[model samples]
Target chain A: AQSVSQHNHHVILSEAASLELGCNYSYGGTVNLFWYVQYPGQHLQLLLKYFSGDPLVKGIKGFEAEFIKSKFSFNLRKPSVQWSDTAEYFCAVRGSASYDKVIFGPGTSLSVIP
Target chain B: EAGVAQSPRYKIIEKRQSVAFWCNPISGHATLYWYQQILGQGPKLLIQFQNNGVVDDSQLPKDRFSAERLKGVDSTLKIQPAKLEDSAVYLCASSPAGVRAGELFFGEGSRLTVL
Candidate 1:
């Protein structure tokens, strides 16, 4: 079965610190990658997605992700993060067209202190 | 545009009790999805529907869980004789565009606790 994995389960950082959450997946074929964020008391929101083209995809809230097919990884990165950026990050993937189910990683909880 | 709506922000039931959750997807959304997110974990896809038809439910425990989207709109998910492990947040999502790709709007989710 296909699965997604996030290396860090919990992270704490000061405001303005750089952020990088590692995500990796196990799939044999092409896939659509995504990064989602869930702020407290809020629903999950899209951070960015990679369907095709450039490996580096920019998303809302100064977030970006790079899809490295060779590593089966799509890591989320932010040069500087604000306290408001503290939230749970999830990496997900669905098989390119042929697969329907979108698999999500366990998640990484980031706590940004001001 | 309105996002997906879910009812009963939270619920607590005994292990053997049955529970149900309701969701109303965004208007005109052809694809609807049900996901379960346990504490400290990412959302897990339970079922998917495209225009009232089942698209993918491989992860759903049909023996104790069932879901339906009537008329390709509103949806309901039910769990019979729920177990303690069934405790989790149930999320409803919609893809206004086809299920092909891109963004998915999600509801605030209904948290369930089975004692």
Candidate 2:
């Protein structure tokens, strides 16, 4: 079975602090990676996705993620984060063999203090 | 374009009761999805539909849970003899067909409280 793992369960940071959330998946085949964000009381939306790209994918809101295929990792990064960025982040993966199912990680909650 | 719409935004039912939720996906979207999101956890895929056909339903609890997408436009999910562990937010999402791993537009979700 394919699975996703997010290292950070919860994080607290001050405004303008840099952010990097680690995500790793357990799959040995072609895969599609994605990061989704859910704001308080809001539905989940896509942040970014990587299929066959330059490894570095830029997304909306100054967010970017690097897909390191060898490491089986796709880490989301932002040079600086604002209080508005506080939300829950989920890493998802869809294996080529089973494109119908997208497995999601446990999620990481980020709290930005203003 | 209108985003996915879900009905019965909130539902509370005792264990062993039955409940149903409805969803209307975006116009022209052939792929629809249902996910269960427990508090403090990420959304878990329960089923996926392509057009009027079932594309995937591996995680759905067949014994007590059932879903159908009629006419490939609207969908309904029902839970019979609901269990306490079934308390969660049921999310409906949709995407265009043939877009592999495409972005999913989600609805506000139907929150269920199985007491």
TM-score of each: 0.96, 0.96
Give the DockQ of candidate 1. 0.67
Task: Tell me the tens digit of each residue's lDDT in model 1 across B28-82.
Answer: 8888899999898889899999889999998999999999999999999999989
Q: Which portions of model 1 show Cα errors greater than 4 Å?
A: B98-102
CA shift of B18, model 2, Å: 0.7
Residue A86 accuracy (lDDT) in model 1:
88
Q: List model 1 lDDT by residue over A9-114, tens digit each.
A: 9999999999999999998888889999999888899889998899999999999999998899999999999999989999998887633668899999999999
- Given candidate 1, what's the lDDT at residue A76? 94
DockQ-based CAPRI category assigned to the predicted complex of candidate 1:
medium
**Candidate 2 chain A lDDT trough over 10 residues, lowest sum:** A94-103
lDDT string for model 2 (B41-61, tens) is: 888999999888898899999
Candidate 2 CAPRI classification by DockQ: medium
Q: In order, what DockQ does each candidate have?
A: 0.67, 0.62
